[model samples]
Target: MPVRFGRIAARMFLPKKHNPRLAVLLMIVATAFIAATTLFAKALGGDTLGPPLHPFQISHGRFVFAFIAIASAVAATRPQLTRPHWGLHFARTFFGWGGVTLMFASVAFIPLADATAIVFLNPVFGMILAIPLLGEKVGRIRWSAAAIALTGALLLLRPTPESFQIASLLALAAAMIMGVEIIFIKKLSGREAPIQVLLINNFLGVLIASVAVLAVWQMPTAAQWAVLIALGICMALAQACFVNAMARADASFVAPFSYGTLIFATLYDIAFFAQIPDWITLTGAGIILSGGLLLAWREARLRQLP
Candidate 1:
């Protein structure tokens, strides 16, 4: 297992070539794995399993298992996560952990589709963050796109009697943090290997979750144990596939497939929770995606500039 994982890590760090078709295929599949990870997490925390776990405990277990997998991979491959960026790494992981903390809890309260869609607004947040973080310029068109995206979020947030959910708010909060986290990743990906970044991210998650999880931890039953393990495995695979996909393609090329998360989330919701998003959610999600696509087009154009 260690040897096999080592090879995976090695490939992650030093890809000789980029394959667009393969990258897209891998990303599409990775999104499905990510969707499965969320499903497992929701099951671990939901009433369907009886005696819901604490969000921190779930995070703790996730990082713990992910660490085991990643460590084993690195142990054999020996990818050194050395040479600086300590502050940025810490900042990125801090926000990344916060997103995990909130998103996990939010799933307990909201439908999967709504939570995932709210989180999907990360690109818009990324555009906003890029000015300071990446020194990237956004023209009027992109800023206008942001306004339309905000309107979409507001529409989803309309306080209808049966449709409004506080959990959706939590998810949005997580999504915003995730946006900042992605900006950090954009910086890091240029300087560090994917394995190194993932290792540090999970390592910090373990340390933070260990302390937080203690206050609310509960012993996992056998079935929950299996699901949690599956969650770890699924997430590790998803992360690996995602990093590889991004490494092989430009952000604009990969951005659209990221929306596959919505389809997978909706499918899982129907299969497990028997829920479907209402018109408001669909409409709002459409608007948000429109803005995100616009942002991607703008980014591609910027990259093409001489």
Candidate 2:
């Protein structure tokens, strides 16, 4: 039974051939699950308790549950926990932990749709960051697309003197850090197993979130438990899909589909929180998605050229 389970689990996380279509499909599914996780984070932050739960504590619960949930798969499937590339794994953990922390913190106070839209800025950053960090070249069209995408994010943020929001800045920072994180993941993806990649990040998140939560920890209610469970299971499965998607397709191709997260997130926001996006928000999101798609198409064409 154990062997069979292990094989089944291992098969799910293992990388497959380059299939842009399959990668897009997996990314679509991942976006939905990730949107739900964001909603749960919002719920936890604004629960009935006199003081809302700390974002760090919520982050802790998220990874702790995810780590526990993935344990069965790891025990049954992976031959080893630690890999040869310890340095890369630790670096990934550092960047991933920072990104996740900021992401959760953003959702706790911002509208889900707004937060989701801004995080899609990673592709723009990824394209630009690649030149320096990964020593990759970017053509003029991609550069134009990056500029358009940045403009779109600014449109979505639309900071006003009277209505400035720190959450928006946090989301942008999360996207920037995650852009670097994605590049690092690409560096390691071909060399490391996807499951172990996820495990390393989640384990580190559990450790970091645990220590940070100690300053503002509170007991979880039953409802909060359900939210955390959903966060854990959904994020674990979502991360698997995302990692595999990137491994199988160009990051640009896989990236634009992430804007689909905005759609799902907006729906979740409306359905759960009764928050509807104003015309400006919808307009900005549309521009953002267009820019992201443009970047993806340009990157894909570049890859096909040589």
Q: After TM-score superposition, what is the CA distance of residue 272 in candidate 2 from its true location, in Å?
A: 0.5
- Against the hidden reference, what TM-scores do the models get? 0.92, 0.87
Model 1 quality (TM-score): 0.92
What C-alpha lDDT do the candidate models reach, one value each? Answer: 0.80, 0.79
Which residue pairs clash within candidate 2? none
Query: Candidate 1, residues 1-306: lDDT per residue as tens digits?
Result: 656765665565556367888789889988998888778778888867768998888878788878777776778777666675877888888888888778888887777777777787777888899899799888998998788778788887767887677777888898899899988877776787778878888888788889888889888988888788777767777888888888788767886888888789889999988888788878988888788777778878888889
Residue 282 displacement in candidate 1 (angstroms): 1.7
RMSD, every candidate, angstroms:
2.1, 3.0
lDDT of 2 by residue, 1-306 (tens): 434544555565765899999899999998998998888888888855334678887788888877865665687665565554766766777777777778889988889998888888877887788999889988788888877778877877777887677788988998898898878777886685667767777887788778888988877877787777778878877776787788788886587777788999999989988899988678877777888888889877776886
Q: Which residue runs does candidate 1 get wrong by more than 4 Å?
A: 1-16, 132-135
For residue 165, give model 1's deviation from the true position in Å: 1.2
